[model samples]
Target: MVLQDLGRRINAAVNDMTRSNNLDEKAFDDMIKEICAALLSADVNVRLVGTLRKSIKASVNFASLPAAVNKKRLIQKTVFDELVKLVDPHADSFRPKKGRSNVIMFVGLQGAGKTTTCTKLARHYQTRGFKTALVCADTFRAGAFDQLKQNATKAKIPYYGSLTQTDPAVVAAEGVAKFKKERFDIIIVDTSGRHRQEEELFTEMTQIQTAVTPDQTILVLDSTIGQSAEAQSSAFKATADFGAIIITKTDGHAAGGGAISAVAATNTPIIFLGTGEHMMDLERFEPRAFVQKLLGMGDVAGLVEHVQAITKDSAGAKETYKHIAEGIYTLRDFRENITSIMKMGPLSKLSGMIPGLSNMTQGLDDEDGSLKLRRMIYIFDSMTAAELDGDGKNFVEQPSRMVRIAHGSGTTVREVEDVLSQHRMMAGMAKRVGGQKKQMQRAQNMMKGGNKDQMAAMQKRMASMGGAGGMGGMGGMPGMPDMAKMMQMMGGGQGGGGMPNLGGMDLQSMMSQMSGLMGGMGGGGGGGGGGRGRGGR
Candidate 1:
């Protein structure tokens, strides 16, 4: 809920405008005021807020737009486009290349979570196949080396630090040389911080930068500091040629907007955000998506990307995807899927990735939704080995067993029944899409091992799975082409005919065409044909 208030205010203003028959100048001005108020309330710098308003207003040209264009939509587009710029500041960021020893230095004040953010950045690259190493150069702070060592050991990442090396500059230079010699892909140097900015500390930071000659210098800012972020960001920006910024503790800070806009004002791009204590809780910062999430317009692409990343890396993930795609799911499968979803992040965060679901799932991170998930997990935990055996069909026959499970999980029998009901729904879906294993397998393969366009990849999966054939002889299998009709058409109802070779066809579009054709045929030929017609769409 970092910018929840701002999001709600902006969303309400947009919704109100959307409902209007026509948008006059007054309505537009009022919308701007609401936006400005939201940003101001979130402690955004007044100057930038004014610039944002001006940009939005300047972008709107009623006279230039054609008669067919929606005035309201144009205004909305202007708002979105300007908001993207407001946080972005068009700053260039350093992109770490693979198979190279890229040195990154983290600098921040004490209590800004700089040390933890260093590990988080290390973990980020490490998970993506980089040989990442951590260097503890915080010789100024007490136990800095120990803290970094603990974090490094926990992540299983190698580290270079010493208890005896009191000079940070010496430690940093030696650590960089050591990592470079070993040919580590990414070497992150964790520097010391002061409680408050001083000439001594700033001078130390400059000396460390000189010694290391880091490829990128990142300034870390704690988001909870509110409006003081401007001065804090300015202080760091002045000291080091900050290539990027990492705002820590953004998961629950109401002043996240202030810190973000403040740092962005320095023309330094935020590369990532520390959402939680876990290293994996770090999220790559995207300006448009950030504003979209703030406005209650969910980031669907981000959601899908997260899903693919988690499921692909997870154990038995490929199998899970295959089962779900083939509709061979079960209660056990459902439980596994639930576990995977939880691994992706909180349900509330996931919900924001889906369009139109953000508002409905607003309070999902609170007690209500979290409690529901915990209860379900507990219920699953309490199930006996025999009861959870093989697709969990045993639970279907015994109603009394649900009562026992509810008692064990410290919940109601009604909740247990709800879980069972969910299982049944999944089972029914599995049965509905049976026998498309080949297509599903192809879809699963298409989704793995890439950082390409997520929606495009999904479309390719659907299109590839819905490969050649119309709707016939495949029953209700999802994306299954009608081999019989395909061969029939290819041969033109003659002998020596077989399924057509529609090689390299975009099956997603073809499926749509086939659905329309089948619908127009209107249950012709046979009952199976009618079933195909019904399912093709």
Candidate 2:
């Protein structure tokens, strides 16, 4: 995520300039140099970096700007625009239309993760209601077919391949024809790739492409190749008609800017980025939003879209929202929440979509952290109906309750306590969020092609959620602050409105303090709270 780090640095540099009384060419040049260094370090092509620097300098005419104009804002805007232009080719690429046979052929080097990407692509389409199937024409790699079959089976996607077939063209043709005969609308053919761009591999790829006449040929590029990505993409483009690029292993520590800019150099559009190893890790590339997320500006639109992809019916969504809005979430409700979030994909990814949480979650690259949520589900499921559904005070006030629940759930007492602690914190915040539902509703209504007022309302509501400070949309979120009357309501700052500093509490410590919950959970009587957002609807 070096490119992401670059966005953060660029944002910070711009802010530094704004803080100073003197805004001159010297300051501007310094920022540009920093950007150049960052891009170059991220393996961006030197020529492209030079061009971007020139373009930014030409647009940001700080010397001639009117005194009344905001210097910092203009410069930031120019930087964002220039960076986007550098990466976006704006090339027209194929999109699968419903009710038709759309064939996609994947091409790449042997280790570029081509086969896995084919399954991922097939799963993406399959989830979208496409009649999708996978065809493995990769006969060069040992166990290529077996690898594809394993991935396809896990994703529950139908696949076609042959152990006996030596000719990739025949295998591809047979698979496509078989899926087509079954009236499958989306057929993805994964072709052979070599250790290098050798003639034999190119010949095999060309034969398969000619036989199938693919509707779109997607070239999967490994982002870790850094500076060489451009040359690699260019070389491949010369051999096959690549309609789009898919950058894989983007979740790694590789400098990815080179891969992105290099592919764009060939006028090829990057349609998706493989964020992780899972089938659902592939994300449709959105340049501006990607940059925004990288800069820690929350992509609420993207977040909403991810949620929608996994959520099934309206009732299931609404019921969860009800619990969140009421500040009365039970253990049962908590389990459902965890289940729903798991469906949205990786926790680190989901967390990064939130405003302030990105910086915090950027370090959580391990899959083990995500398992914590699953553990919460198991621990909570052990509780009795009275224990699960009740306000959390019983567990907090009665130590024996924790013991009994731990025994019932087959978990350690410490784990049970941790689950209760998280529950209490969630329940408390739900009340606060529930109160702001009206303001959030107003903002959403205004957000339909609306202006700053929508963002203003959202900012205000977000502050009230007990997040550390104001967001920069001005700065998690937790998904904001107007204090005066609300703070006074909780008995002179100690009221349920003014809950304890649950933010910094340790997992172990928070578990034992569950009685502090608002509404019915804690010793403090919980007040009423409610809301109606997209999830609420």
Candidate 3:
């Protein structure tokens, strides 16, 4: 089973026990048993599973608990904390300082995706204002330098490699010297990997380590190796004395739980996870956030970070915020929001960051989700300038206009109607919250001024609105609503007659209807037919 299935099984077990009428010791034991079984099926080490079971049982002794305590909350917290402990090694990874060349070397078995990960990490740092570069030192593998060159060129990051230098160590030293002389912030050296733990590979790793003297040696382990990750990580640790780990291929059909648990047993910190093949797929691994996402609890903090990172220079976003503050959300504003979300990354990945969205889009993959978002854009593109800037009420007055748009955009009349409906809901939300412009400006100023107390108070209010204790605080960008107000609208609160009601729609229907309104939009019907429409356009 994949991680999602494992999470669902564990969640179901916990919910079952908590909702039981008895809520006795037997139900608790049964819940534990079900969770252990799920973990074992996910290829977690047998000994580690046993230890986790014991730790959870010891922490939640039903007999010792007082009758007045909230048993349900206690049990839920115990489960979340234990799962986090299972993956966290309680060790800090190396932190690179700016204005200095921080050399980071990569080591792993063959087919572990070291070359690709190097470019991904380089681009990740580069986007965050770090002058990063890549050094390809894999002389053993044919065309390794060429692969790195291709990836580096695509990412537009400077790279160093040689066609004549057969010695990996020499190439590594040269690359590091050149980049350090240029004063690069982060320099990543990609070394070759072998089929197994051979003596030649070990000696070569040592040579590269001695040549570059990297501040941090990261071991890239493939998740498909399952429980064997423990042995592989141990061998590399002894030979290269690496300081950190990065697990690749977690997005594949691999039973990643085993590899994660196995690596954690070795007391090494996992710094990042390669979630997909895209350059933007590397996710910073935080133990608590990882467990929360795995259990379908959502990671609002990650979502906020993603948004802030991608929207720092987005003028359209700034404009939309201003319009919303003025109680105005035109069709043009809706189009800009959809376009911005498309640039943020894959829709499938972003959906998981919201509390109930992942479940709603569970059946849609990345490709389908992207297509849905593009079709929404095509609909906006087909509209005339006047219609695009209008409030969408004209379409309601003349229903024939919907047919013309559907034909022009290659979408159906129903899809066009859906878009208009979503726009109306968003317009209503903006109008209702326009009165809080002063409050939003105060929150935005607090965030910009780095007022921790005010920010904390705002985050607390937002968390209460979400009913999720640890939702991350929004930065309250210019013209944007305060975090609390945004969460209130999302959670469908009743403060000043919250967001327009959806006619008592179920969770799935509500999510589908509000897809374009929420930042977590995408994933719905119109895949097969929408492709033709896009092609024609």
Candidate 4:
């Protein structure tokens, strides 16, 4: 939260300060000081803050710029650059090697969310259709095996560990052998959390590493420990090779800034973040989005991924995006939007990805929020195919249709009406923006400008989901607009298209219309909502 707050203040300062023609060295210095103070107060490393301030001052010089240039944008870009550098100097992209299981070993102290984090990593791979197995190598902690086993069961991933296993290195070796026997794509070894005084356990970890020869050795740290992270990281670095770090409890006021900012100081890539207790709460680390969120600008990567995932392969997905960018989105596109969103998990869940949205979604109860989203999707789904693909006028003209849909979807007619109203608003917005390609280009350009070389290097990574195109393609998805669109649609988003007027259309009529659309487009396909549509096929 402090990071978000600091980002907001810095954005405001740059914007407000740039309006003045009489820019002075003192002004720049003052702004840098404010930034340094904010970061330091947020528990960022003091030395890192000093270096960042220096880098920012050198990169942005308002006085030397032409009067036509916007000082605010310059400062914002500079700040973005500085933050990116601080978070990811090397910008290492994870690539599991070919022809062998990439052994990933997790190490950390107790209460660092290590067990949950490992499950999240396993889930990430499992969702992508990888053959992944979880290994509970933490024999030192009681119930640790149970906790990890529960997570593994939930993810449906194969796991190996003994409740009474005394030797951690042997347990780890057996776990690796089990996964290897099963020909799993990857094997993740979850080691015990040893206290500083647990010299024997720490020594065992090195042996575990030697036995496993892990491709990635990640040190999990509780973000709530700010300055202590440095010392802990140093100690762990001395014992085992830590390829990256997973900072847990980042969703709270955990001073993750220090842990993240000090990663460079510890010489490790901050690979992933453990934001919550759930198995699905881990988010792959993206430097640009982290910087943007730190500066209150919001996450461009998350937005893009969400949209791409939601719009995948639907009839109106890409076109609607194109229309959205061109400002021509219509009511029909709005209805499809609801359906698209249903394909995703929940609105509240996705909403958390945006900066400063945690507070806004605080009142959203899990049951009620999920119920609302489900009801809305069902209401739309129960309508005739034509109604979904067309406007209201093409559907039934009677009020009884709405009543039927409500009953069918198990929701009140008002909820269905609300869904309809939301569609209308979205349609209008899309109609206003005739094309999405330009907007996408602008977004890509902004990202490239902010994180160009780093992203380029990342793009070279092999595909993760499958050959040719997958999660491994240059981070997330590959290619522009289309790949981005697939990521969004799968991630979730509203689609494009002008539905026929639904103003007074009856529910039966709408359902019939929707039916026709589904049938016409090879309806009843059980494939997940996120895939290639448009020219993608």
Candidate 5:
């Protein structure tokens, strides 16, 4: 089973045991058995799975539990904690300080996506305000330099590689020295990989390591290797002594669990997970966040980080916040939000970071979701200035305007209508909650202050708004079955809410609104083969 399926299976087992009338030791044992089976089927090591089984059973001692204790909550928390232990190496990875050179070297077997991951990691740091560059030292493979050059160029990262230098160690030293002289914060050297752990490969790896003396060495392990990851990681550890691992191709493999668990067993920290081929798909791996997102509980912290990263300087978002505070949500505001969401990353990946939207976007892939979003943009682009600036009432008063937009945007009138309907829903929501400007400002101030208690209070306030006008009306929107319930699940109702209150709205609310809007525009449908309509522009 794939990681998603594995999570679902384990979640189902826990839910089954908790919901059982007998909730006795027998049910608890059965749940443990099912969870172990799921992990084993996902290619987790037998010994590790056995240990996890015992850990869960020990943690949730049904026979010794007090009668007043919440058995169901205890069992669920134990399962989550044990699963987290399976992936948490409990070792801190090397953190690069700003204003200095932190050389990072990549090592792995051939076809483990070492080169691509190099570019991805470089871009990740670059986007985070680090002066990052790439050094391609893989002289063994043909066109390796060209591949690195292409990826680096696309990501706009400075790269150094040689067309004539055949010695990988010489190339690595030259590149690292050049970048260090220029004071690059993070310099990633991509080395060549072999078909197997041969002596020649080991010699070359050690030579390159000695040359650059990278502060951190990362082994880019292929997740499809399954339980063999243990042996591969051990072999690489013996030779290159990599401090961290980056598991690639996890988005397509079922054995990701095995690879993660195996790597953790070796005590090597997993820094990031390559969730997809996109440059933005490199997710910073945190054990608890990973496990939470895996089990469909949502990664609210990750979602907040993504939102903050993408919208930190967004004047459009600021303007929209102001408009919402004044009870206004124009088509232009919606367009800006759609643009921001596009930049945040793939819709499917973002959906998983949300608690309830993942189930709504179940069958939708990145390509299809992106196409739907692009079409929405196309519709906005084809609109008149007045239509976009004002509320969507003009389209309703003049039905012919919808037809005109449909023809201009290369979409159907129904799609245009759906977009207007979504706008109306959001406009209504803004109108209803416009009176909470003081509360919203207080929440925003608390967020900026970064005080734990103040943030918690803000979360409690947002959670309290779940049943109120804040999110109650959103349930009628498409793809949003129950906004209040979803918010509650996100800990909004609980004192330990995870959702971040940005401006006046939370990330979950924004994403759910986007999902609902996209769903109305047929987001779940297949992609259009031809180019999007730009005719009337």
Candidate 6:
């Protein structure tokens, strides 16, 4: 959505040039000039745009490319690649050093969502099995500690804070020591947001960093800043490691050219993007896919990975496979699959991640897609266990079931029917792919390859080919039980996904059921919240 304007401009230029048979050198030059102007208007650096235009010229020059190829398509690909290269060049590739706690201190101006970002980062690592803790060193901001504490409570991670104290340095040092004492895998130090030129505030931040010795120091910048990003980045980099950048508000319609192109000016790698305000809205920056989106192409690999990450615990997945092998697939597993998918974000957002969806999303906007997905989900939620597990013929035998679901979810019967159709299609596809190792391998390869074009084609074909019965297909496999119920059980509960629970129930029940589970859920158990529970790429 951020690139809609730029995409229109680029598309117009290409169309104007290739729509006619007249191939004069002057016409090509005019089109390239239009593109260059559009990029510059979008706050992209003149030099970078010039470089891209030159590349496009070289690629399309009569001397280089084959004459048979469509000039517009060639230009599109060339421009797309150049855009991808620009964003991908300086992206952060650094990982936490082996066997060491990667101390990352978040620094930003006030109202930049610094505290929220810290918890999201912690949650991200926590899911990867990292023993993560939080250091609330923002003594300057009133209630900063409490705001972070609430999120920490939700995540069930730990937080080190002193309401009565104002010395952020002491807080940082104590937090680091507490984390080390308990052997936390990662510790994230959150700092007070300050004005860019506040020397005294920066001095405190410097001292805090010296005390904790963080492995990574990230600066969170609001994407709304546009071209002014350079000055802000410079001011922050002057006082700290400024290891990576986290650009927030990217899901909006802002040009964001300033945010992305700032990489060219500052050479700071963007590590993550804040797509929304929620904890799970933070996503790792995938340079290539981002550039593709900017150039109006789809990003399939990123979409698939999003699905995999969010649905890894879905019913009939790895654990289900294990259970099925052991003969444990049950009704509970089906519910888990449904709940987990809901938490993973909207189905429309998930759909956008599929490659080659460029045309599929042609006339639609984010809000439109999201609304459709919500309606579809509503339909699914209204169905009973019997209906969920029943065959398509069962739904056909009783069309009133659709009317009931439609009324329950405040949707149309047609919408309910559409959901049922999708479920039936998916169930059929799963049956077809059952035990087909090669087909699975091919899909996996497409996902891993990270090529948007090829991946889109694969996704389209797979969608058409279909799968069956939600996650229940696992029930027919050898030794598998109901995976959906297990996922539902895992997904249910209070306080979200970061903490450990006992009583063998949802997150809330576990917290209420066992004190030890509570200890492990917060920072007190391992590294005072910044503990390293697990580590990986």
- The lDDT of each candidate is 0.69, 0.70, 0.77, 0.64, 0.79, 0.64
Worst 10 residues of 2 by lDDT: 528-537
User: Candidate 4 on 1-537: residue-level lDDT in tens?
Assistant: 325555656666665566657667677777777778777877788888888988998887755888798666777678778888888858474677545687899999988888888888887766555688899988888899999888889878889999776898899999998888778888999998887668988889899998888888999988878777777788898888687888888767544566865487676788777766766566677787777665554554554444443454466765554445555544455555555545545444444445555445445555554545444555666776556666564323666767666666655566556566555545544443333334444555655677766445434432343355543243444434444553343223432122211111112222332333222222222222221121110
lDDT of 6 by residue, 352-392 (tens): 44444444545545454444444444555666766654555
Model 5, span 1-537: residue lDDT tens: 138888889989998998898888999999999999999888889999999998998898767889999999999999999989899888889999999999999999899999999999998888778999999999999999999999999999999999998999999999999999999999999998864548988889999999998999999988888878788888888888889999888778465766876566679888888888888778888999989988999887777666655665577876776676677789998898788888877777787788777777777767877777777887888787888899888776888888777777777777878788877877777775565554445555665677988766656655566546555454222221233344334322332223223423546347656666555776323234333544353
Worst 10 residues of 3 by lDDT: 499-508
The Cα error of candidate 1 at residue 67, in Å, is 3.5
- lDDT of model number 6: 0.64
Model 4 lDDT, full chain set: 0.64
Tell me the tens digit of each residue's lDDT in model 1 across 380-481: 777765555456566667677776776666666766676676666556555544444344444445445443575365555545545544333233323223
Task: List model 3 lDDT by residue over 419-440, tens digit each.
Answer: 8888787777667555554565
Report the C-alpha lDDT of model 2 over 251-305, residue by residue, as the tens digit.
7777788787755668998888888887778888877777777767756556644
Model 5 poorest ten-residue lDDT run: 475-484
- TM-score of candidate 4 to 2 decimals: 0.69
The 10-residue segment with the lowest total lDDT in model 4: 499-508
What is the overall TM-score of model 6 with all chains considered together? 0.72
Per-model TM-score on C-alpha atoms = 0.78, 0.75, 0.83, 0.69, 0.84, 0.72
Best by lDDT: 5
Ranking by lDDT: 5, 3, 2, 1, 4, 6
Clash count, predicted structure 4: 65
Q: Rank the candidates by TM-score, best first.
A: 5, 3, 1, 2, 6, 4
Superposed model 3: Cα runs more than 4 Å off = 325-327, 344-347, 365-368, 432-434, 442-537
Model 5 lDDT on a 0 to 1 scale = 0.79
Off by over 4 Å in 5: 310-328, 343-346, 365-368, 428-506, 514-519, 522-537
